[model samples]
Target: MAFKENYDSGETELKSKTSQDSPIHCSIDEDHPCDDGLPPIDGGRHAWLFLLASAMLEALVWGYAFSFGIFQKYYSTHEPFQGSNNIAAIGTCAMVGIAYLIAPLPIIGMILLPQIARWVSTIGVILMCVSLALSSFSTSVTHLILSQGIGFGVGGSLAYTPSILFMSEWFVKRKGLAFGVVWSGSGLSGVLFPLAIEWLLDRYGVPTTLRISSVGLFLLSIPFLYFHRPRIPVSHAVVQRRLNFRFLYSKVFLIYQIGNTVQALGFFLPTIYLPTYASQMGVNELLSSLTVILFNVTSVFGSIIIGFLSDRYHVTTCLLITTAGSVISVFFIWGFSSNLWSLYVFCIVYGLLAGGYSSTWSSIAHEVQHANPATDFSVIFPFMETGRGIGNVVSGPLSEALLKADGWQSHAWGTYGSRYGTIVLWTGITALIGGIAVMARYLKCV
Candidate 1:
């Protein structure tokens, strides 16, 4: 009855008729069938080129935020903002956190005013660059928070949301892989930027590094706009379908989002704390930075692999795979790590598992869209990202509290003996809770 009702509404639907069935079916956009003379859905020169540009833009936009651990390390020890409490909040909560939180706004705007998508993206880039430039002039932590944290977060949200919208239009069958390729850019840059930022911070200090970064990103991001057009013509989108929120009440989305939010709570903990943790362990600064690099490098591959697998498997299967690996890395590898070898192992293992978590979102969208065909990916995707943002905003302060909490330390050896032990346990527990969706799946709640 529901599918017939959705079919009458001229909305797209997956070939599979039921939610219990695997979503590995042809996604038919009944509103714009193949005879419509539009560009091909999955594979075309324009599509691949667009995907490449999106990936590169993803790297440029998110790379800096991903590499904020280096900035966090620098701010804790350097002049001006040194000895300031909650320095971690600038990167985790203000920049990345706020971006994820407010991302739905620009996306909502784009849905309403599809014609201005390119201009919005351009404005977002300019805002991000300007934010970085303003951050260079900061003399206090508050200034950095406003400029780098809030300003860049707002700008990045504007610039990035259009890609997600256009991307949904560009590739359907291979949407998971498309998202994987695009998201890998963040991890790819994560590999390169940490070393580069560390070098610049050491050589020219924070102001010069921030200024140079702002200029470099502006030049790099501008060219990608050429490839960022929507696969569907905007004139067709002018119909302005009513926004749907029925899927929000579904058990399937709720279960997956609970897992997603819980996972995000601990997802950023390692990236935010790893460099400083290594430096405190008597590792050289270069080696300390290398930890972030290794983590990001594995994530690049992890995203691609998980994306590929998601296309062929169920979303819960993919979620469980990533979750199991992540929990193991946190509990066994990171918890006992007292040396570079074990720490490096944790970064690689954890990055591969958890870094690929976001890539599974496309599949989640697919599943949710199946249940509520009238709801578009544009609606579901932003809400999913907002869920993650909830965790990201809380993680910075939560991590700080865990680090400062007393009675967790012991007169022993390894990570359990150190002040970081509580942090490690918290990370593991949250990661474990993040897998709760699998149980819900087994229980037939969906």
Candidate 2:
């Protein structure tokens, strides 16, 4: 591990000379262009390009997951293997669930077995890619359960964690914007993939679409693989220490972690259920699904705006404001939405809040991990990604239970007339919980 240097001792001073960063990070060396101690890159056109690429990669990875709701609708009804969301979730949950469980595996390897962890981790990625391609031909639930649950989930983990780690390492001052831009991939995917996948699914059957999408996911990793490199290398010395849960025990960190996990329990439910909820509310299928698009579109701006805020405002304050706003927007706007128009309003608002939720992950990570904004963020970034992966996996099952109240063909949640209302309620509660985390930090109540 690098020795901890105080902010003043000219070590950090070297930061400003190289990049708009602290001495801890120099981003411009030939061998490690991202980490070689270059000066910080200001947020501008070059920065925006980085954002765009990050968004594209994210759209492919995170967006695909968000769009699974669209596929979920198709899977639930039209097959020789027709099933409920709960039933179908075995594959989805396993993919996501295993993704979470394996996160610290490599980190742990770094501590226990340095030499083989790197190559073995890459092999895991190979296995993950194979998992999806195999899912296309499955005829039974077990096929998907094994193929997607184990293969794709683990594969995505290996691929995604590295990209995020690289991005954090590469951009310091602009980390929020960079993360925000990449973070928007989830939003962008929500916008683009659903429409694309829906068309492909309708034109080709699920089996064919899965095959194509698997190939697409495989191909999609190339750009990230080629362009994304770690700014700073993880040192063998750094790996000598055991996995520390000290951060997990920190007041602010715990608040953020648990709150985020709880929020995620429902944060994505809206994206997954909005289209179905719309159809149940008597909206047309085409229009119903478009809500996902509209919601994602609005989220793009929200992410950019929040990225701006996170850099300009205090991270805790920015998180508090966004979380509070999200609670209000989801609870009142999405909670009571009754018609297509109401949902439309809800989508834009909710989309923006959703975007904010993601943009903060990196910025807050920097603060909590105490890494310089411009230095290699590789040290801290993966932990947050792990936190989020856990959040994503848990959100699925909890939301599936709430979403079921409306049923596939009906709008009522058992006796209640609001499926979306129930969905919104879940997010609102979780969001408020996240807000409490921020507030606890500010007030030192934690």
Candidate 3:
């Protein structure tokens, strides 16, 4: 008789190994004889200090990310470079590189432990500050790409990673609440920074605006760097030898991996195009910029509320609610709307829902991992971020293609007519797909 393989034993073992929710990861949390990885989040002096400092750091880096729409509007409409939406988007693409692109390295570093990652990331701040200062002098996109995109992207990712690492370590039971506060910094930035940049751009021009932002980013980096300590006791020297491929073969993680891939394609299109759409509506460019600010402001409150609710209620349902809100807001309200008020209404509703989904990443990721899922998070979050990055890039060219076909930019709504409705229609479909995946994949819970 031919020798039989051990496939049946492995299949039975793998299913038993996964968490109660779904078969996403071969969770060692069940039998791994070890200390629970996270540290206490007692409101100690150090914790509060680090939290406040972290909040400021988040405010600067993410503020820039959220307010890119304001910059997009200015660049698209202003002289010397009255460019199309695609060209203007390159700057924000730099921001995307930091968030979606650089997600992995730091997670790897965070996994190794605190000391090495923390000190290494501190050096990242200097690199970012210098890039901002250098980019201020740049006139060409290549220069911005080099100084802002490459240098700042590298630095910002380093700085931002620790904030995430620390959140997992410090706040366990209250992780959702703490995460809501930390992530809400972007919404705060979205609210205030864009409006401020508009004034600075009008008064000082793009170059000057960049210089000012760099100085502020650099200053904010200091206090946070001083206080960010890791509470988790991770061993850097141990070579966690796991030759078994059992954990890699899970159904739940596979589904989320697939879900994240589809969702990423159209996520940022609204933040990127809202101002352009406003301009198309014959709204003043300055007021158009305010649309982003308003959305972000609304997001600040929305994130906190949603995050709190997720802890009490079902996270998957919360995700569905947000996804459904985004689809309806985009396809029906944003797609058909012509005037400023209708579009603005859509933006506010969308912003609130959008904020809910964005801030919940940490909680959902952690909860899915449940009491102990270090490995699951290590595996999944990067894939989700990768999906988001691809989604952002895809949307840019997509907007360009639709605009070329429709000549919507030159039509009555100006740039808005050419692209806004198209973006809403496309992104809504993708978000709906995300909702379907969420419903089907997590339906047992619902």
lDDT of each: 0.84, 0.63, 0.65
lDDT-sorted candidate list, best first: 1, 3, 2
Candidate numbers, best TM-score first, in rank order: 1, 3, 2
Give per-residue CA lDDT, model 3, range 1-446, as digits (tens): 12244777777777664433221122223233124533335356666777776766667777776677777677666754475334544644565644566776676666655458667557777777888789778666666667766677677767766766656455555666666777677788777788788889989998889898888778767767777666544444332421112334455544554555456556677777778777766777677887787788878887887777766666677777778887888777777676778767877888788666755566556544553343445444454565566666566566667555654544634223554545666777877776654665456531
* Candidate 2 residue spans exceeding 4 A from truth: 1-54, 88-92, 96-101, 106-128, 241-245, 370-379, 403-416, 419-421
lDDT of 2 by residue, 1-446 (tens): 13454546576677555544322233444244452343334444444454455566556655666666677677766775586336435434666656654666554554355444334435544666678678888776667767766677777566555455445445656667767777667776677788888888889987888788877876765554434334344445433222344665555566667766676666666767777777776766578788888888888878877887887777777777678778877867776555678778878887876667767776667666662232234444566556666766676676666666654325543213554446666678877887665667667654
Error at 269, model 3, angstroms: 1.4
Candidate 2 has what TM-score? 0.79
Count of backbone clashes, every candidate in sequence: 0, 15, 6
- At residue 261, give the lDDT of candidate 3: 49
Task: Choose 1 or 3, whichever is better by TM-score.
Answer: 1
lDDT of 1 at 374: 70
The prediction achieving the highest lDDT against the true structure is: 1
Please tell me which predicted candidate would have the highest TM-score against the true structure.
1
Error of 1 at 31 (Å): 12
